[model samples]
Target: MMSTATAIQERSLLGLKHLSREDILAILDRASYWEQQSEKLVPILNKKFAVNMFFENSTRTRFSFEMAQKRLGVQVMNFTAAASSVEKGESIYDTVRTLESMGVDAGVVRLKPSGVLQELAQRVRIPLINAGDGNNEHPTQALLDLYTMRKVFGELQGLTVSIIGDIKHSRVARSNLWALQKLGAKVQFCAPSVMSAPELAEHAPYVSMEEALKADVVMMLRVQLERHSGGLFQSSEEYREQYGLTEERAASLLGHTIIMHPAPVNRNVEIDDAVVECDRSYIFRQMAHGVPVRMAVMERAMRD
Candidate 1:
């Protein structure tokens, strides 16, 4: 006979590949309960250890993981691009081998290039949660964002969601689209053709920002400076006029559309400052939920 924890333990949430629509709903149901009671709950991960191995510069995602782990009493080993020998010589696989030798348990990782997390998933027997991997996915961020949406609007099905900007270089864009589609939201992309998802992303991306903004939710992602291998556009001014969310455009769609951005936002480049601060905005809530959601991820991993 399986204990409740044992049932969850035998299940591995290694990838979206393993999750059904029902599985995601169950995770969300659990996350919502945790979000409400997290402050009252005793630290569960006390003495257990987790590691953060990031290959990028981040504010919300990195610190959120640390806070989440700490809140659960999980000891954390933090490593960034600068602090480690990743600067001089060692490969990522070698770096993980080194960490494994240190007795770290499960780790949450952020890296560049699509499919890198999949590679790491194979390499590490310990559960590896994907933070952000190039323009491929940010699973945890998507989870938090979806939780926010459900809290604000009550349901996702049939609601229009516009994910705007840098889709070609944003893991958030890809992950959000995946989650939104799975939950029955009508998802669309707003970007220059070059910055849009590749042909296989299903929906034909809108070249005109205005066309995509007619959504119940407008989610803007920051441009990925590090991954823009080529200048997607010739000039910032031209880019702003054509595709950027200007004040004029904001006023046009200003009423009830919930505006969101997965930080850090390139203000005036992808979104108008006023819109980001508007009452309709959920940017900060999205950031705030990061801690609880990551806590949920860590808890589930440890239970497994």
Candidate 2:
């Protein structure tokens, strides 16, 4: 009979919504162990090959997954839409099937369309990890973000987390809402009227920027200028004054309150440069935690 962990290995991690609270905790506990030994490479994934198939461009997520794979002794195959046969109009199913034929044991995929990863998972035999799928979810990122919060507060129950900005187009926000709420954290969404989604408001109530900044964790999201059509906000300066985490706003938060952002920040647009480096900011630490959390996920997906 297969153990629970072994059963997890056979399943595709398309979203956090599919995981139980115990499963989420198990991943976090495993991540904590990896965090303690992050500087040392492990052979947990020795002799395995994992392919990275990213249809959308990314910096932090792509590199962190590659680092996690290498640190665990897995051979990395990097694939980009521009360089791959995807340019020749090949389907995602064909691309993944080709990689599988080459003995790729697992894959981390990021696509611009929602639910495509889940569709691909049905056709693929190996475990599929969703890096980010459109405006749907980024499950691993939510895991890392949860890990960061747990590291700081030592618990997630009853804690308040306010996710600010670009909620309509943010996969991070979608993932975090589900994961955080499942772990007993109260989540609130704060965004420009145009950027707020009614669907998310059903999970987390929409709060004003002032109310959101007062939470225990203030997570500012990128404005996602590329994803938006036209005129979401009236002006950059107006948005900053109303919603951005400026130096003054960050300073006003109690010392116990922490500021966070999923990066490639717009500098002064969503968050001020000074606020990102402020004493209460955990923005960079969040990035540091990404490797170990992802390492935990990879280990779980490939465990025998």
Candidate 3:
């Protein structure tokens, strides 16, 4: 019950690999239309059942999905590790099967181990949608991020974007890289050697922070403080010197460039406080799209 996905799971989505480039564009296009809709949110997901199985904690993404599903009238059954049988030795595979037997149409999962979700999807009768899987992928977040970019920049192809910060541990980085690449954007990574994303090197040929900032878009990723290990850095100052996006660095970027970020920003660590208040920053817009992007995800996944 781990690693690669199978036909059972292929019935849902484990990564973006199952979908074609055109399928990706179609999802975004539909998400845009949903974003413009009115108060009939509750009617959309009616009669459908979606289970939220999160091994890790999340507020924005989880709540956003719940809200979107509720808006669409889908029945949601939420399960968190703290309050679920997971604490009592109920394996993820078993839990998935138990829920599937109850007629759950789809399961939205967010787990810490990469690719574990695909295992669950492969065996389940229901469709599977990954919320976030360790540092592997968070396709929904990427979708919303892409949706936001298209809304602001009007296109993603040829746009240059720098994704800066804890690339080694950030699922956000992994997902965004693929999402941006599929859309034809030039993406760059900027992180400390310890925090640097070797995993991303396979996807990005160009990995310079300075060059990435020269592009049309730059996303500041938060430093994951809770997960940081000892000896990875000599000092916070040193880390900042090598990797932090200070106010001065922000100013050095192109004037017309838009600043982006996925939530829970660590003010002085990955991004300067000044940049959050910057007119060019669209971090907030990313959150706003979470609702609609998820709406599209749920709708498409649950479609009969």
Query: Could you tell me how far off, in angstroms, the CA of residue 131 lies in candidate 2 after the best superposition?
Result: 0.4
Model 3: weakest 10-residue lDDT segment is 2-11
lDDT of 2 by residue, 99-168 (tens): 9888988899999999888878877778999999999999998999999999999999999999999998
lDDT of candidates 1 onward, in order: 0.75, 0.88, 0.80
lDDT by residue for model 3 (160-272), tens: 87888788888888878877888799888877677777756877754677776787888878776556767466656666666777788889988788888888777777677
| Ranked by lDDT, top first | 2, 3, 1
- Badly placed stretches (over 4 Å) of model 3 are 1-11, 40-42, 225-228
Question: Arrange candidates by TM-score, highest first: which order?
Answer: 2, 3, 1
* TM-score to native of every candidate shown: 0.88, 0.95, 0.92
TM-score of 3: 0.92
Model 1 TM-score relative to the real fold? 0.88
Q: What is the lDDT of candidate 3?
A: 0.80
Top candidate (lDDT): 2
Give per-residue lDDT, candidate 3, residue 128.
Answer: 89
Candidate 1 lDDT over residue span 1-304, tens digit each: 8754445333434345346677677777877767888374457778677888898777678899888888788889888978789889888888987887788777778887677777766666567778787767788888888888988889899888888878777767767776777889888887767776676366534546767778888888787544555766665656667777777877778467888888887777777777678777799989888877777778877753
Worst 10 residues of 2 by lDDT: 3-12
lDDT of 3 at 63: 98
Which candidate number maximizes TM-score?
A: 2
Better of 1 and 2 by lDDT: 2
